[model samples]
Target: MKLQKGWKLLSSAALAVVLALTGCSQTAAPTQPGTEATTGQTPQDDGGQADMTAMLRLNLKTEPPSLDPPKGFDTTSNEVLNATMEGLARLDKDHKPQPAMAEKWTVSEDGKTYTFTLRDSKWSNGDPVTAQDFEFAFKRILDPNNAFPSAFLAYYIAGAEEYNTGKGNADAVLVKAFDDKTLEVKLNAPAGFFTHILTQPTFFPVNKKVVESNSKWAENASSIVTNGPFKMEDWVHDQSIKIVKNDGYWDKDSVKLAGINWFMVNDENTQYQMYKTGQLDKVSSVPNDMKKQLIDSGEAKVDSDASIYYYRMNTKMPPFNNVNIRKAFALAIDRQSLIDNVVQGKQTRALAHVPYGFPEPAGGDFREKGGDYLKDNDIEQAKELLKKGMEEEGWTTLPLVTMTYNTSDGHKAIAQVLQEMYKKNLGIEIKLESKEWKVFLSDQRARNLQFSRSTIPADYGDPINYLELYVTDHPGNRINYSNKEYDALVEKIRNTADETERFKLMHDAEKIFMDDMPLVPIYFATKIFMDQPNVNGIVRHPVGTTDYKWAEVRKK
Candidate 1:
């Protein structure tokens, strides 16, 4: 799912936890079946006490490599981490920023600084959460030795660049704990979406004491302490992980479910069978063949997932460095046909690098505004470009390039289709490689493949997340694509607060990238999940992990 954009507030729950300085009194009513039951419940008058504790079974393909939010790439781990840890702010159902660990914040008139006031909260270990934790986490991520993928999240923070470069002390970085409860942030420039960035799990606080106590702080489940609604009850690598509600949480009343049991099962058919037998509470990434059966039986729910599928070319490689080669490859593909035949109309054909409904200019669509840059398929043009590219590289024929994809049936099918299309339409020889998800990620990060399929889920409901990957010197620029002009436009967009001017600059930058075809636009994927009728209150976010904080299930 994509990240949420705007501010969204919360609603009160039926049960409340009485919190005092020393401890809390556990007194809540028992929950019903087919519902998100409570953990700590009071005895009822009928006959026997009801079981307040409920377990949610989730189907996952793989276990997260690390629970450390800064070091992992698995979305499953992100989902669990989001529940167990909180940031200064969080996105609500409306995709707007809402209070989480920080009760409120203020942006300076110049928009270069933000100050946040923390709420009186405690970690699962009962240690008080302070602003120092945030400072420590931010500095740790910025450390070059750590080499966290999420280090970019703090790049915009004031003085982060200097700190990251080892040119300045950690204390000089933009983040500072004004006192035990208050925190202040400084930015290099006016960042309009800075608060939205705070909602991401990367910005969550990490206890200094906890990290020091266990050098492998996030390596084992026992080493970490939760500051959000849930805590890791049990975690077995590559097997299963269980999360139980943190009864000591500051906002414990809103968390209804007692716990969630996440199972790691890669086989799609096995997961489907488990769902049918009521062993799985929720299942996503459904295959195309079963869509009809599930829909006909009224068991499947479809939503437009905020995931944009695309293929990135390793610009550091030989032919890919040629713009004509990249453009020819982009134009040769029949996106609509792939969407209809390969994905079975489950996805939307992507017109621009950034998909539609991503908040671009109002007067015209991105493609229309793009002019010649949005050129559609032309077999003759693709053939001409390929001929020129091969001749420029002093070759009679194109090299046998490899395209790597994740080891899913759907991904394999798409890869085969792409291979055939390029060979037939553009006379380009291509090879297909499929690997496990984890292996594929590692290989991609290491730039081991010539061309790789990737998807970007919006971090804060902005187009910049997709565009920034190609910026000069960006660590996530795994393909090593760089353009000075493109970087200038990106910087301009970031500095400009005027929506109209910013969009114009953004569109211009997108046009430049499309012209070069650093990444081929594929399609926006649609999320298909299976949920029983009793399931309710689960809101799917467009950008980040789906929010289940306020969700409640009720039996008919």
Candidate 2:
């Protein structure tokens, strides 16, 4: 079944979905907790009393690059935005879209238009959230000068791409505010995962009045006003941030935690120590050496992450510019060993470039259907490919290649392992470089690294979400990979409405992508965290942010 309204999800190794199509129907309204089968999350039943003064203390890992929703491109900023804002729709525990700011929405007969009736909601600053807010926000995302990384998403909205690319007038973009409460949108084509993607950070509405008054409204807590369950209380740049529960929230009763104290701690060992000493309620990063012990002792929890942990080979750079060299380097790594000995049970060897949790029309896992791409330990083939690649480049010695990773204990471990693997398999020595998170992201976006360790989490639930990353010069395509045929294939997939045909095209596209070998597939990431038993109800979606809306820290 195609992704649509009234869909029921059945989980297998990945996902199984049954949904309705060919209809103009009003989506189900959001129900209060305990009223629906999946209401995002349920508090853990450890027989502990609920803490009256509830606050979750966790590490954000790094300073968020931006608090402005459209510019909050990194995961650190994504988490902060997820807690501080609300979008038209929010994903339930089952990964199904539920009414959020919009009380209900209706789709057009052709599935290319959507009309949303927003519920009565107020910002922390006491302004009423209106449809005009959404209208302004959508256009702000598509403004060519803004260059928001997520602008491509709004391209589905009729004329949005034209405006974003400076080829059309902004007034012609098919997003409009019919009134104070009603918003309408027209799409160039049907996008089945539209609602799913709406849960992303960039889709959240911004306060136009506040922004107009202060261009840097999102720069500090004093100027920011949020419509979500929480609002920023304080931000001490690069140190810590404190968000307090928004008293004016429309659904304040459902929000359990009083606030979240987000600390910026880069080292896993320090984070784990903080957790052990009760300075933190939950810690997502811990020393790699302690992962298995913690998991085995039931001190930590491991959840599947719908993300790919891989190395991006700059296709425009030397050595990797040769397809054979790219494949050779990709196939040299022992991914299973990396997972088993280093990352522990926190990850599994990725079977394909697409991580998991997407279901095909015939109810099979997308990964299972596509099969594995590169042989992880193909040493002889890797050596041969390296020789041929060097020959093709007319070089007696390979170019100076460096593997770069963001500074982290686990990342350092993985880089060391890969370095040894390359030396053992391809008889090549490569340099390793580490940078701070912010610097790393900046340099990577600039395509400054030759080979870089990278992890990509799905922006939405769908097979195409992963495949669309390599589209010609996409902002997300940091590796600078460009292939006209692959770009055309993605275009065909985007325009296609049929489930079987789309999946078939996606498979073909993946084959082409793997054959080109722009990036090396390492493993599918897993969320490994140690939480104090009393800290419960935090809903961490496989694709999106770790939600604090339904969370509570119980009294011991």
What are the RMSDs of all candidates, in order? Answer: 13.1, 10.3
Candidate 1's TM-score reads 0.87
Question: CA shift at 358, candidate 1, in angstroms?
Answer: 2.9
Weakest ten-residue segment in model 1 by summed lDDT: 14-23
> What is the C-alpha local distance difference test score of each model?
0.71, 0.81
lDDT of 2: 0.81
Which portions of model 2 miss their true places by more than 4 Å? 1-43
Q: Which candidate is the best by TM-score?
A: 2
Tens digit per residue, CA lDDT, model 1, 1-556:
1112211111011001100011111111111111221221111224332223666678667867667878774576688788788999887766677888998888899988899999999988889999999888888888877778777778788778677767776877878897988889988877777888888888888988988778787876777787988887888888888888888878888887777788988877788889888888677766655654564465675565556788889888877878788878887776655554445434666656775435544664443354334444556788888888888889775767889998776677677777767766776778888888888888887777789998777777667777777787676787888889999888777667777787777778988888778877787666567764445456566667776675544433
Model 2 clash count equals: 0
Error of 2 at 318 (Å): 0.3
